[model samples]
Target chain A: MIHPFQSVASNSDGSLLFFVIKNSILVYSVKDSNDEFKLVGEWSDEADSTAIIKEKVTKEQQRQLAENTAKKLKANDGTALPQEHKEAKIPKPGQGAPPIYQYIRNVKLSRDGKWLFACTDSDKAIVMFEISAEDKNNCLRLAKRQRLPKRPNAITTTIDDKQLIVADKFGDLYSFGVNDDQPCVNPEPILGHVSLLTDVAIGLDSNGKQLVFTSDRDEHIRITHFPQSFIIDKWLFGHKEFISTMCLPVWAPELLFSAGGESSIFSWNWQTGELLDRFNIAELIQPFLTENHLAPDRFQNKEGNLIEYSVSKIVTFDSLPLIAFFIEATKAIFTCQINRDSGKIALKQVLEVPYNVVSLACAETTGELIATLDNQNSHDKNFVAFISMDVDKFHINQSKQQKFDDFINSRLSDNEIANIEQEGIYPLYHVASLRKRGEH
Target chain B: MRAGMSLDDPSSRRQSYRAKKEENRKELKHVKIDAEVVAEKVELPKKRYYRQRAHSNPFSDHQLEYPLSPNDMDWRKLYPYFYDESKGDMTKEVTIADIGCGFGGLLIDLSPAFPDKLILGMEIRVQVTNYVEDRIIALRANNVKTNAYQNINVLRGNAMKFLPNFFHQAQLEKMFFCFPDPHFKQRKHKARIITNTLLSEYAYVLKEGGIIYTITDVLDLHEWMAKHLTEHPLFERLSQEWEDQDECVKIMRHATEEGKKVERKKGDKYVACFKRLPTPEII
Candidate 1:
């Protein structure tokens, strides 16, 4: 069962993968090929929340204990205890109150990976947190708080790292200098989209200058120069419904992929505003499912039913033409390979997850697929899991077992192996496979 | 001939006749001139016109001054007058004189924008002097003024020559120029006005933090102004967060007549602005 709602973001060097769960963010080095995401370090928004709660709970417990002790002494001697003695009682370990709710909507590392920008609806402000890549104890600390005009829908940094662009629900885009002393302000109004902007992607344009791409509720992908000075560059229009997500191809400056609420994915030439290719996954997946229909008896639900689902999230890696999309309702994720140069689509694989998939991200440097699955029985928690495509795992001459064996030998020592064999090996194999695929 | 012969002999007779004739002519002329000159005697004095004297040297003690009104101005004699009737009623508008104005054409073109702004040209050299003066006169510019000055008038003094003596502190609201000679060398740094010392002087003569608009065809000069102006304690680079941000950068490339000339030449123009900062605290 999905145990926690997890979100994954990769550092620029691709040497580390940062995972977010609840109010905590953890970074796991990808050097070792073990499914085990070792706790390199973790920063907790929970600590602050928990500390406040603990203080309140401990104060109340001390007050109650003091009152109770004072009454006992009074009853025994028919006199009140001294204030100093009564106040010495400490709160018991399990008596602390639970933490308040703080949802982590998104977490992004700066281009240099020295800073982390986190946005939470709980505060309605984007907080920039400084982090040290070399020091594990150097957890994320709030550096600056940029308040938005309205609740921010999305935030992104330009490729140049000179500017940070934030879009709000009211269709306002603000550009701020990364090192400006004064609070960032909107220089001018950018007008093109008609509805709430859902996502924003900042990339280099044809001339290698910074360009901003914003997907809005009107099903249009509008691209404009950053800083609002070049407002009339161009626009790309193709989606038939609200564009749910948009991402620039990691390796290609001109290529862009966008998915709409209607289950349509489009490959676009952002520079020339041309629709290079399009595919409706809902239509394509229907025939593939009919051809490979499995008997109902073969269906297994470790956490929930896996049927009645549609693709809700999509991600693409740099080296592969395959797109990984999550079918949330069915708890299954599928990889579809598209021949963009020739316009052909093929369903590569569909694997079942332990719980509902909430989000998906693909590592560009390594073809490791990651998904955030809702934690079963825990409404507020989710687990981020990694899965490797069979093709990516055994690309040329490597067998799956050989890859797994190589990974296990690299991560565990002789004594640990003997202990794992004597006690158990299932967890060990799972860790080995995840590590071999560079998914952790 | 040696003997005392008769005066009628050929050579001796001619000599004696000539001598006698010269003696008689001298005696008669002297007697008649003296007699006639004394008869009509009258006193005569030397005549002198209203000639203003040029300064013995430009750096001497003479102070320059601006004319209160345009009267007997030589610019009216030059052709292609710089101002016309189209300029709004001149009585209400502010008259600004760009002294040492190299190429007065810019002032002529800018005169139409601020229709009420009466502009006067002050140049030193005679060639350009006559050219602009004639250009203004030919255009029948009633609002423009130009004249020659040898001592303390507008036509001849350098901009720095009498700036302190002629203009009061905080008298000017705006001052602008395009492509002033950069004189690029460490030794010639004092020639640039956007320096720390000169900015203070400009601030003094300018209204409280008044705007100084400047543009140059040279990139170094652009950066130079930007750096000095932005670092000055009293001045601030308009933050990027401002709503009307970069408005100056826009007008800088097109509004100035010099800018148009630079554009036609396809040269890059760098523009910057400095608002005179408030005076520093007195210790």
Candidate 2:
């Protein structure tokens, strides 16, 4: 039922369910000797978020940060950021891009339902919480959680659930081992890439070996061994544009789905390094198209072609076979199913969202239907999701009957259509005919 | 009672529109606009685009309309001062370009310095370009001794988009990026005018051994321009000897309005010049 939150998870028994609502984790216990349900505990990330946001930086912290900035600026007065621009004269470490620390961008719960981990965009840190106990709403006491540095683009438990793997914006993959049920802050940098990594997911090869799948802004999907991440296994390099999200849909975990900054989604089999299918989502979003081009807000950087859109967030909803993802600029969520038999991703459903979906998390405890109800215009309680019981008998509902075509037809008059049709039709090798037509 | 007599039919309407357009074109061919006729119609449409100051998004409202190719542009209108009386034609090519030519100060100084070589200044701000045009026109009208300002013209266009449209291949010998808008924020670094993408365009139109002179008061921007220009394969850093010996470099330092302002404020004006290298041999 916690569909619109940062993360939601139900224990293996489906008796204890919890979701990150705002900064607090609302844990519910469905345990019943004679049919009873109760919220067992609540925990807040208020302190960590406040520290991460940095907008409310204390005077002393501001002073210190300013001094650090000035000293670096002095060093970089006559040079560009050496890391990015290699040819800059005095190449020096710790004097590149200015440090920007931001708040928690994601809240991820471990698969075994033992720990909840989150990563911030700018502060470059991951926080871990012990979410194992069956909680009583606002009644359970908690110990302090550990914080580690690195601006995390995505976080998840490793294949064995023994370590937390974090995808960083600075283009590094770090693995943190769990020591005594608590994730240690010291992370081992196991893998590296050359561009800002957007997302990472855990998947298994055909041989049943656990693998790490990562995507970056450079339009690359890399597959590496779970334990030995230093050795690159294969690169699924098909995306023509930057990849913003990666998902190993539970139903098709063998097929890696990469989206974002693209008009289509690519599904690759990490084991064999083969692109199983490329799903062109343009037709599904035809109604949202801005007549002559793709939606401007989504695909503004379409390199002068102008007609395209960018996908912001994509995630897997466990209970459903479809991929629950949202596209930015358009403010819409689409669920597409991977036809396991055909190895094709077929568009299943599309729902326009209220506001921009900055991030998304799975809520498998919720039913099959991805229902969204817009609440009152309050930051804390605008959108809500319910674990729908009516959608139990769910199938791929690809409603091909589009309502946008009529709208588009209504937008164009007959004269405009005629003018568009008169546009060459075919210029061919008719240079003389072009001159006769008075077309330059 | 025709079957499709509705107003939506475009074929009939297009025929009538074409007939009217031909009639108008015939009439336009017969009629001519003299200076007096132009002045009668101009009326200088209320200068609404003028600003006493420049904003970061000053030219955001400006349209990117441009000629399709080099042949489409009428070069005579761009370089009126280069009208050759002996040949009765205007074939004099523009050998220099001043991008973001704010107040026409650099162009004015270089007009007489390079009397035979045509110089063109591209400005996006409508009123700023209009002001530069008026200054050049006035300078031409007042002078009886020389055709100094005629070889110089200011066009209201984005140099980044329309450089190739205005110039032939390897047409320019010197390109000036004097006192360009800094766009100090890191997010605005790509818009710094000296990016690799734009340098390639500049290199395309600049003759081999041509010089690109850039001067700025902002240290960060100076470093950014220098680094990008140095890294560009088509360009190499000009020596200090050439920097001191070049006449246009001196004009770039002290002639532009921004340069004068920076000088008045006693700010550091970083100047760097790069020479365009010969084209690489393709296999």
Best by DockQ: 2
Q: What are the per-residue Cα lDDT tens digits for candidate 2 across A1-440?
A: 12234444555445655544334455555542432345566655545454434433454455655556666643336763322222213222276764433334556667877776755444456667666463433533443344544456777777668777888765667777744456454554566554556788888767776777777655567676667553345566566566877777666667677777667877777666677888887777766544333333543454555564566566565656567665553445677776775567878667654443434444454543322222223322323232222453333222211121222233222422112222212111111110111111
Worst 10 residues of 1 chain B by lDDT: B43-52
Q: Candidate 2 regions off by >4 Å?
A: A1-23, A28-39, A46-102, A135-146, A181-186, A288-308, A316-321, A329-331, A352-360, A363-382, A387-440, B1-283
lDDT for position B280 in model 2:
63
The candidate 2 chain A region of ten consecutive residues with least summed lDDT is A429-438
User: Any idea how many clashes model 2 has?
Assistant: 12
DockQ of model 1 vs. true complex: 0.00
Please report, as a residue range, the 10-residue window in candidate 2 chain B with the lowest summed lDDT.
B40-49
TM-score of 2: 0.44
Highest lDDT scorer: 2
How do all models score by TM-score?
A: 0.43, 0.44
- Model 1, stretches more than 4 Å misplaced? A1-3, A12-15, A46-101, A180-194, A283-312, A327-330, A340-346, A378-382, A389-440, B1-283
